[model samples]
Target: MDRVPQVEFNPMAGLRPAGASFTVFAELREQYDWFRSTVGQGFWVLTRYERILEALNDPERFSSSAITVLDPEPAYRWIPEMLDPPEHTAWRRLLRPHFTPASAAAMEERIREHCRELVDGLAGKGGCDFVADFATRFPTVVFLEMMGLPTERLATFLEWEDTILHRPYEPGRATGRRKALAAVVGCFRELIADRRAEPRDDLVSAALAWRMDGEPVAEDDLLSLCLLLFLAGLDTVTAQLAYMFWHLAGHPADRDRLASDPAAVPTAVEEFLRAHAITVTGRKVTRDGEFHGCPMKAGDMVLLPLNSATRDPAAFPEPERVDLGRHPNRHLAFGAGPHRCLGAHLARLELRIAVEEWHRRIPAYEPDPDRPALEHAAQVLGLDTLPLRWPA
Candidate 1:
């Protein structure tokens, strides 16, 4: 750890309540630039903009197979997301048509209506838990629509998702994860069978009919494909939304500006994303290499917190500031390289509509005094409760 500054670099440290990530990011960059951490069985950490991009921009050097420092038990690779190059390319190509920009755009009016309904429930009420009221429900229901899952069973899907992503992986919760994953796999297996027997106008049915390299997908591969889609489509959006509202509740000026001009939301959303970036996914070193003067060995985990790229002073002036209209914004919030997020288009549309609709209904809101917003950070940074108040 040559010239490395004294900083708390624990992976679990950032996974707790309150916001201290940017502080650590700033401190580390100013001192050591980049270094190694003991967390996740000793990972090589990169935080600077250019250094992070250097790895992401070149997949041949850094492998996406183990896309997280946290290694899942039984060595499960999550389809295209955790696969590299040729294998990833084929699966993604088969699934790409289902999530194109046009597909996301087609669902805009429907998403807007859902946003209005969510706001209508909270409108004129003195306050409500923003996370429970809107953030989680809107995305969950939309995911249900896309998957053709039963809307009335939203609680079941939400429960499975929460347990898998949020409850943690201690010995006590090991059974919890098993139960949830088993339940999900069981349900989706039935859904896939139904789709093959009788096609429907949904992602599952569409994927069933798709071929790659001139062959139908294997059953195990199909299950893995749907599993990743279920987790990806439902989880990240809610966390990002919770963080966005947390930002809006704190910054009255930014909130006011967005509320005043709906057109400014797209750019504002980008800035919000940059400032509040949260995922801490990882990649493995493919071979012996040196990045920014840091040495690494084959099979070493390289932690890439895409959000930290926002704090890179070299890439952004006043890197901490949230400029709603910052142009040429090259934030890696959706990520970089070939294995980037497949649902970016859908995610952007949801955020824009959610922000626009929420502000139109309740423009002036802040953190509730009696019950402050609670922060819960982990592999995914989010808040379990975001209580917001407006004029009664």
Candidate 2:
């Protein structure tokens, strides 16, 4: 394979306008097939739909050892996420039953109940910072309950979530990331110890009983898995919710479609997931190779910007249009191939319930003209603030 001419581009270092991440991705896809970003350690990016899918499916070459480009050579592994092949396969098998459609179905009622409780409180408020007041809290409650953690400390968990995920990377700004990660790990370590002693009927306890290759899963590995869940479970849905609502708030016709039909909410969820695909996961190059002309050496990081792939014009006709009834929406919102999101069913369930329940109560709303949605791009694209208003 011959090395190809590559442009140096940085996707992570920027302030994105409201819902402009998708626009930025569109331009990137039009301009460059791939580029080397010197954002963190430096990584190769695959922007086209076909190539991104190829890399995701071909994990043997594009290893999951380093899922984030920022920390290309991470000191710690997050269990299944950073594991490759058989190890990743085993973890997925263990986790599959817990996140199946039936499992997600079982939680729908509880999810709706939680969604309504939160939405009901906001019904009279006229307007609120939806990100703070609703988006973050809704999934955090459900996640805590699933993990068998005390929901009473919801505020504290939210704080830790903000610190670990929302804090942007700055040069010499390791303190916040390290401190937040330590706090989460320390908290999980204690939880693992407690679950080991008590052995309750929660996900943690279920994980405790897992065996890999006829051996009990190690305590350290358990902590790592829990850490992954903590980061993934709490953050992903919140980010999705932020973007979904932000879209709906601005586009009332889309909002009305969900409110009027009710049945359309499910498909609308899919469309929103497609249009506003948030996650930007990466892979580590396994050996010396060239992917479609770009040279990649062993230990080099490769970014799979899922958002860019989903909106590729080649894949989706009129890619930018948010068609609520978009059939055959094979978007990589939950990713593709061996490492597709385990909590995908749960995420869909949560998003469906959230849209259904919220619009049922607060039907008509729009983004506050004065204070706009604050958008950013990192490992995930999300709104830090979404001020929305309706008639009191």
Candidate 3:
């Protein structure tokens, strides 16, 4: 067997011609075996499937304290995502119960109701931008509802999330984004203050009243938890839904299979997640380590390309093709280990409901080839705008 070749991380190496719908970063995972890039002065890049997983599982050896590659000035310094070990675990524990299967299952009727209304509004329209009209809005609303925020304030949540994820490094962008996010946090602060006065049946109220180690979660902790939930739940899953629908529209046969068997929705959701897995989680080596015969020194950065890993031939056969009925499918789209996505159950539920409801209404949906879709390339890879049309 030929060993996979390694390449230096040259960001420009993968640039496509102007106006290209897709970029080389998406393709480089398959065409080039591995690439080395510096995250900071000392950090290194691990761009392969096997090594990425190994690093994710061994958080003791590879710490997630460096989740973002951008400089850590501004308020970005304190988000829980940049913390390691016991600290990260503590924050995660506080937020986990709210997303439990029981909790997520309870939201199904509400999710379906939201989906029905969104789709019904555009029911007979000849075409629409799936990303804005449905994908982006749906998850934002669901997350706000979960967090006990007023549904009218969802735009505030979306603006803040986009800033944290996309414009962390840009001063102008960060300023506007942070201001809007701070406003929402201010609202939460008041809500927390109010909940203290009059508690209610919501995550915020529950979190306010709840205790950890005999101390109620502080205001900052409550705000940080809400921030994490907004970033995790809204950004990733919305993009996942857009990508799934894009693929389904292109593959009519798969759409037919799903439309014919609504029961296959769960299986199809799993397959879509596996096939279009987004986000490249980063970790830094805590100590010198060896993975797949490659020496990784302390402070080195590793990129876990979930999409590439899902398609690894060693893991899944015919890794590129969409197999809705794929059995025994185990992919790391949601990631693995302690940092595995906390909202995985809710994300899957959202995807299943979105697809089932979509096909039930528009079985023959297809993308508008004339106006190609757009994808956001950050830590997470996802569709920005997916335009589609069907017979009205």
Best by TM-score: 2
Model 3 per-residue lDDT tens digits across residues 291-338: 665566776666666777777776788877889999888888998877
Q: Compared with the true structure, what per-residue lDDT tens digits does model 1 show for residues 1-392?
A: 56543333665442444456556666767776677775546777788777787788778888888875655223566788888897888888887887899999999999999989989888878788988888989987898889877789887888898777776545343788888888888988999999889988888888887777778888788887777778776678888898888888988998999899999999988887887776777888888867767788888887887767877877887778888889878888888888778888999999999999999989999988778666554566677888889986
**TM-score of candidate 2 to 2 decimals:** 0.96
RMSD of 1: 2.2
Cα deviation at 15, candidate 3, in Å, is 11
TM-scores, one per candidate = 0.94, 0.96, 0.88
RMSD, every candidate, angstroms: 2.2, 1.7, 3.8
How many Å off is the CA of 153 in candidate 2?
1.9
List where candidate 2 sits over 4 angstroms from the true fold: 1-8, 170-172
Cα lDDT of all candidates, in order? Answer: 0.80, 0.87, 0.73
Which model, 2 or 3, shows the larger lDDT? 2
Judging by TM-score, tell me the better candidate of 1 and 2. 2
**Model 1 lDDT, full chain set:** 0.80
